[model samples]
Target chain A: MEGVLSGAIGVLAASGIWLVLRPRTFQVIVGLCLLSYAVNLFIFATGRLVLGAPPIMPRGGFIDPTAYADPLPQALVLTAIVISFATTALFLVVLIASRGLTGTDHVDAQEREP
Target chain B: MTPGPEHLIIAPILIPFFAGALMLIYDERQRSAKLAISLGAVMAMLLVGVELLMRSKGSALTGFNDIGFYLLGDRGAPFGIVLVIDRLSAMMLVLTALLALPALIYAAAGWHRQGQHFHSLFQFLLMGLNGAFLTGDLFNLFVFFEVLLAASYGLLLHGGGQLRVRGGLHYIAINLTGSLLFLVGVSMVYAASGTLNMAHLSLMVPMLPEPQRVMLHAGAAIMGLAFLIKAGIWPLSFWLPTAYMAGAAPVAAMFAIMTKVGVYVLLRLALLIFGAGAGASAGFGAEVLIAGGMATVVFGFLGVLASQGLGRMAAHLVLVSSGTVLAATGFVLAGGPVQILAAALFYLLSSTLATSALFLLIEPMGREEGGIAALLALTADAYGLDEREENRQPEVGLAIPGSLTVLGICFAACLIVLAGLPPLSGFIGKLGLLQALVASGSATGPMAWIFVAILILSGFATLTGLVRVGIQTFWASDGAPPRVLALELAPVVGLIGLLVFLTIKADVTLGYMNDTADALLRPSIYAQGVLGAPRAEDASP
Candidate 1:
């Protein structure tokens, strides 16, 4: 479980960082989204791998101690996800607006204008 | 002490949030409704700020529904997402309210003409500003930061001008990048420390292993960069002047407070988390901060020197002020408790006042009669302002009280304050920080002094630029004096009154600043304020 989590996190980080380094605005936005996913997963996995367990215990019987996962990180991840989503939406609109207004998606395009 | 109701902190944040939403349903042209709602929101914020300030001891509000949500410190703790209003935060809220009130009033005068939902956007912006200052949790802090930025995004492009829109895009892009960095940094910190609560992290941080310690510091540096960008520090500060120059005066004034909040957060985190003696190599820390601050100061001054318009110059000054505070932070980091505390407190107060005044002044000075073009032409004709500066934006006569003299005086006073000249809190704050840096035996002592020298020089440059501009507009012989409308003069006068107030009660103000400084240096009060008393024999939370 740790291996899978670490591998996915690594890929996410590498892809996000690579995109972020690009000059395109769309790429940067994509980078941010990827990074956000990696961060969210990283934070969740910090509670340790609990693949078969539900965060909330079943009501029918007293739950096994190791069967339930920590819910705090999940709650936090939920908030982070919502905030990131809003952020991405804002970026998309801004990207479209700027592209329409300035006629460029390349971050350097504005700087290069005489 | 018994926990106060947890809702007090939440009140300041929620009032404007809900009010802003309610504003959207009303007609865009309903000026009266917008004004009343805005007035009510600011008034609520003012009351909450006042309530929080009057208390000597800290209070918290927490609910015990499984996971606790707490608001504690100062007077009473209201339940919900805790809003701890310490002496420092309370004072900031008050200052924010003072600035926002007139800016809002000024916005109302221009709302219809500007063709934006000024009131609704303004309300949400205020909500974000208030929430940013009030939140006890780190994640919530980012939430408020985004809220503020979102509102600013709308407000900046309210007029739909091409230049304004382009400038707004740049501003949004930089801040959005900063926001992502902030998120990454905070989550990394949380993962490393095992707690997201600031108070808990402060305690847990010192015990972390070496590599993790370095990573945490790296996280802090990243977070610092985010705020610094928001604060408009040099290198990352190129977006400020053009962006601000393109905005409506009232919007500019309100946005001025936003940068200060960025510096405020940086200061808060620095003192509370990183500066808690939990990190290795104090020299490295001080050097990094001071150096960044120094570069910021230099660039800001250069920007001021090259600036053509009142708005751009003011934006440059904002950069200088942010840098000044950051530079001063280095000294505060190295200096003894008394010195660090005093300087930090004074810098915060002085910067907030100076920046807000500049914002208020832009409306009157940028108008056609009072506009930078007229001011420049008049100044150039009188003192030979470089005629090569032809690409300047045109200024129109202000819709408000358009007195160039009042505007000149207000702008000059702000310049003086920003430059840390005598008879203003800026001078006192700078003096305190200088005294401390000189006393602290850090290796950066020479560099600190050099930064101080640059600060002084930048102050003079900005002052000269302001005077030159003012002279052209208000004092030039052949220049037609820009007419000052009454509406415009009100904000100018109100800001001046506050400046006078700061001068008159300088000692009391410094005393309060001193207490705030002391509280910052001694993180225990903050720790206790945020986290409930440690259980049993555990020293660290």
Candidate 2:
């Protein structure tokens, strides 16, 4: 589980950074979402992965570090996901406005020389 | 020492929040009601700031949360979200009110009517700033960062233009990237230590094993990058000047303190977690700060000289202020005397006020008022009469339009303050820093000498820039005087008056700042306050 998750994290971050550097505004916004997802997953992984164990505490509450996944990181990641959603929506709005006003889809709102 | 009333600590954050959301019911055309709400909220914020500042000093640190500063209401730092108020934060709160009052007042004069939702955005921005200053945990800090950024976005776009929208896009993208880095950094710290409570993190950080310590250090470096970018350090500072230039004058004025927020957080964390107590990690990033700070100062100097526009000049001054504070703090962490910290705080207060005043002054002076066109017509007439060198009139008897005298006085005062000349608070602040640096008996050291050199050069550079602009706009320009409104001019004068007051009462103000710095340097009181030490009495019910 750890192996697959870490591998996916690397790929996602790489692709996200790759797209973020592109000239087009739409691509940049999409890249931002991908990057945020990658960050969210990375934060989730920090709590340590444990399958088949409830994150909620047992009544007595003295589990070993390796027992259950840490719930705090999961909660933090949830908040992050929500914030990114809002920001992504904001970015899309800005994208349309800029394209309309400047008459270009480029991030700089100007066409590049061939 | 018992914690003061709960309302004092949280009101600054809460009043603006609810007031802003409440304002939504009012129609855009109902300007009077919205203005009343914003004014009432800002006035209440100033009162709360004064009350908090009075209570913060000499008071034992107390919080209810184990995870944050909200521990006093049965929610200690380990689990509850805490809101903290120490001398540093309280000073910051008061400073925010000081800047916001003028900026908001100036906006009400005319800028607010330019766009939709100005009052709401301004108030929410206040809430976010106050919350960020008071918050104790890493996660909530992130939340406040987003809050302020969101409000600022709307505010920047309030007076819509193509340039403003373009600026909004760049500012948003850069901050979002910074936020991602902040989250990664916070997670790394949490992964290394089990808690997000600041004091706890401080306690746990030094004891981590070698490998985990490396990871924590990396996290800190990345987090520091986000802050430095926000603080307008060189190379990372490119977005800053444009944002200020493109933003409306009032928004730009309020933003004078936003960079300082970055500096404030860095200062707090450096002292708490990575001070002399941190053993191997002591002064981890101080050298980087000093070098980067020096570069930023030079960049600002050149930018000031290159600027043809008043707003652009004001933007570079912001960079210069940040560079000075950054370098000053870097001195202390790099093993200079702790007195330098007090000096830095003094400088921080004066420079923020002066820069905000300068930005406000820009709005009144930059208005074209048909002055240049009128002057051009005069020149044509004069040429028609006779062709000769130096035939232009100093004053065309154009009845030097409305409020030019008052505006000129305010502009001169801001220039004096920014240029770090004597008989003003700016000079006093710089003197304090220099005295502290030299008195440490390290005058012979290269670092101290280099710092002094940059300090003197930056002041000269600023003086040159301001004087040239003042002459061009106020004296040389033949345009009709821009009609300065009382609402706008009054705030600028009021801010400059506060600086004069600070100058005359330097002893008392410097003493207070000295004590604040002493408190910050010694973190034991802070730890005890938050942890609610067993031997001490409970701060409150």
Candidate 3:
């Protein structure tokens, strides 16, 4: 499970970086989304990849720490997701604005000569 | 649990927040009301900031060593988000408020009305700046950074044009990437240490084993990269001049302080978590910071010389200021005297104020005629003038308009300050920095000498560039004096006036800055203040 999760994050990040480096604004926007997803998963994995464990403690009991997953990473991941989502939307709007204003979808807002 | 003076620490963040939300309800036509509310909110924040500054300074006077900690939701520190107000944070809050007032006033002239939701976005930007200065949690700092960046994006695109759109696109994309790096760095730190509170992290960082320490260092370096991007260090700062030049005048003026936010965080964290106290990790990135900072200063100087427009010149000056402070921070972290840090703080204050005034002055100065055409004509006039014509009129009094005279004086003051010439705050700041750098005896290594050389060289370059621009704008041009309004002129004059005040009161301000620097260098008080504060419920009888 750890191997799979780490590998998934690595792949996502790699592809995201590739797309983000592309010239098209659309590619950059999509790349940002993928990068954010990879980051979100990476943040989630910080809790040590526990399975079948509650994130909360039972009341009035001597709790074994390993019986529960760390909840802070979960909370952090949620916040990251929301922030990244909003920022991606903002990036898309800016992409469209740039495209309309400059008559190009290139990240530089200029087209290459054929 | 009753409210006390300590509660005022949170007011800086709350005032603008509520004001922003309130202004959102008003439509675009209700400009006057929104303006009034925005102005009121900024004034309130300034008052709160001053109050906090006084309290923090007073605590130092009484030798109490009390750093005000405002725990959210009555929770204890390290477990919940916290706002800690030390002398440094308090001073930053006040500086932000001071800069915001003039920018807000200048924006109200016509810039704010150029786009929708201007007032609300301005307020939100203030909230973010104040929050970032006051927050004690690492994650909370990131949140506030996003808040400010989001608001800044709106403001940058406020007066939408092709230039602004293009510039804003790059700015947003770069900052978005910086934000992602910030998240990754922050999460890695949290994972390694199991804590995100700055004080808690400071404690845990020193005790981490070899592997964890390496991870922590990597995370810190990554985070530093994020800040360096915002602070406009050399290579990372390629987008700054364009983006800033593309924004409306007041927006650019407000951005003068934005770079300082990065410097502030670097100084704060470098001293707090990785100070001499942090075993094995002490002075982790100091060398890199010094090298980068010096290179940035050189780059900024070159940029200043190359820039044709006053707006771009002001943006480059921002980079120069950031570089100087960052380099000085490296000096302090590398075991130089705390007085060097004090000098850097003073430089930070003076340079930020001067650059902001310069930005505000650019629009009014350029209001005479067609922008590029007029500039081209001025250049031709300067270069193509006949020798007999130049010698024709006596070098004495020509009938200069009163408005032009006022603008000229303000422009001269900015020139003097940015160039670090005598009789202004900038010279005093540089003098202090140079003095401290030289006086630090054994610590005056090659890096210190390099920093000193760069500082002096950058100042010279700035002087030449600004003088050329000023001559062309004021003397060579034959256009009518720009119709400067009182509202617009007030902010520029006010900022220049404050710079003058900073010069006259240099000793007192330097004394306060020294004290603030002292507090920063010693992290024990900060750690105790944040972690030792009792929760409200616990404090209650």
Candidate 4:
């Protein structure tokens, strides 16, 4: 599970970087969304990936290290997801408005001249 | 009895919050009432800030527990969120509220009506800034960073010009990237430490095993990078000037403090988590910070010299402020005296005030370009004609054609303060920093000399850019004098007046700043206060 999750994160991050570097604003937005996903996965993996363990405290109400997954990273990641969603929405609104105004997909608001 | 004065820590964050929500219910035409409410909320915040500052200065500010940290609803630490009211955070709250009062008043002079929800956005922005300063956990810091960034976005786009839209897009993009980095950094630190509370992390950072320590350091480095980006430090700061230039004048003024938010976080977190007691990791990135900071100052100077527009020049001046503060903080971290930190904090206040004043002054100064040019031409002719005693243009003019004298005087005050000229707060701040540096006994180093040179040279660069723009806009232009309103002029003049007051009362401010600096250097006290942990150095003292 750790290997698989790490692999997915690596690939997402790589592709996101490539896309974000693209000239089109839409591509950059998509890339940012992808990068955010990669980051989420990265943050999740930082907790030391667990295959079967749930982070819930036992009925006895004591934590045993290396027994269950860490719950703090999960909480942090959840918050990050919500904020990224709102931010992405805001980004898209700006993206559309920018495209309408600039008539170019370039992030700099100017088209490349050859 | 109702949680005592500790509860006031949260009021600065809440007053603006509730007011913002309430303002949303009022329609656009209800300008008078909304303005009144905005003023009341800000004034109330300023009052609370004053109270908090005084209390923090009193005996209550001892040990982290009694002084700064208050778990929300008394939620136990390492789990529930916390609000800290150290001299540092209290000072930040006071500064933010102070800036908000002037900025909001200036906005009401017609900038408020330029949008759908200016008042709400301003209040929300205040809530975010105050909360960011008060938060005691990394996760909550991230949350407030988002909150403030969100509010900044709304406020930036409020006026709805094409330039604003473009700038807003770039601003949002760059900040989102920073936010992403911040999240990743926080999560990594959480994973390494198994906790998100700053106080807890402080206790645990020194004890991390070798490999985890490495990871934590990497995470912190990334997080610090994100903050530097926001702070407009050299390389990551390219987005700041254009975006800020495009911002409405009042928003830009308020944003002068916003950049300091990054500096505040850096100083707060770096000193807290990685100060002397961090065992193996004390002064981990001191060299890099100093180098990067010096580079920022150089770039900022170049930017100031290069900028042609008044707006962009003001924005570059903010960069200069950030660079100077960053480099000075670096010196302190690199084992300079506590006095340097105090001086830097003083410089921080003066520059913030001066920068905000400059941003507010820009509009009125630009407003009269046409009339200013004509006046300049006439004044020049008088000078050229060997003015007889009767033909002298009043060095200080009476009320005529929209008080060019007031605008010019305010403009001059901003220049003197920003340029670190004597007799004003800016000069006093720079003098304090220089005196502290020399007294630190490290003034012999090449780096110290270079830093000194950068400080003095950056001021010169800023003065050149501003004076050039001043000549073009206020003197060279041939247009009619722009109509400056009393509402707008009042805030600009009031902001400069505040700077003058700060100059006059430098000793008291410096004393508080030194206390704040002392608190920062002793992280064990803060850690023990927050987490009730045995002090790492408990055996020594």
Instruction: Return the top candidate by lDDT.
Output: 3
| Candidate 1 per-residue C-alpha lDDT over B1-541 given as tens digits, one digit per residue, 9 for 90 to 100 | 4434545656767888888889888876576887898888888888876766655334343210111224343322211245556766777788788888878766655433355467778888888988888777687798899888888888887655456666876777677678877876776776666666676667767788888777777777777778888887777888888888777777888777877888788777777776646555332365666777788888887888888877788888777777777777665665444665567566767666677778766655545554534334433332222232432533233544446656777777787778778887778777877676666646445776687578678878877887787776666646555555566667767876777777788788777777777777666667665666322224323
lDDT of 4: 0.82
- Tell me the tens digit of each residue's lDDT in model 2 across B94-114: 999989888888887766766
Q: Is the docking of candidate 2 incorrect, acceptable, medium or high quality?
A: medium
Residue B284 lDDT (model 3): 88
Worst 10 residues of 4 chain B by lDDT: B381-390
lDDT of 2 by residue, A1-114 (tens): 999999998888888899888999888888888899889999999998878877876677566756667889999999999987897788787777778768898887789998
List RMSD in Å for every model shown.
7.5, 7.4, 7.0, 8.1
Give the winner by DockQ. 3
Q: After superposition, how far is residue B541 of candidate 4 from its true place, in Å?
A: 32
What docking class should model 4 receive? medium
CAPRI-style quality class for the chain A–B interface of candidate 1? acceptable
Residue B64 CA displacement from its true place in model 1, Å: 29
Once fitted onto the true fold, the runs of candidate 4 whose alpha carbons sit more than 4 angstroms away are: A59-65, B1-3, B60-66, B368-402, B533-541
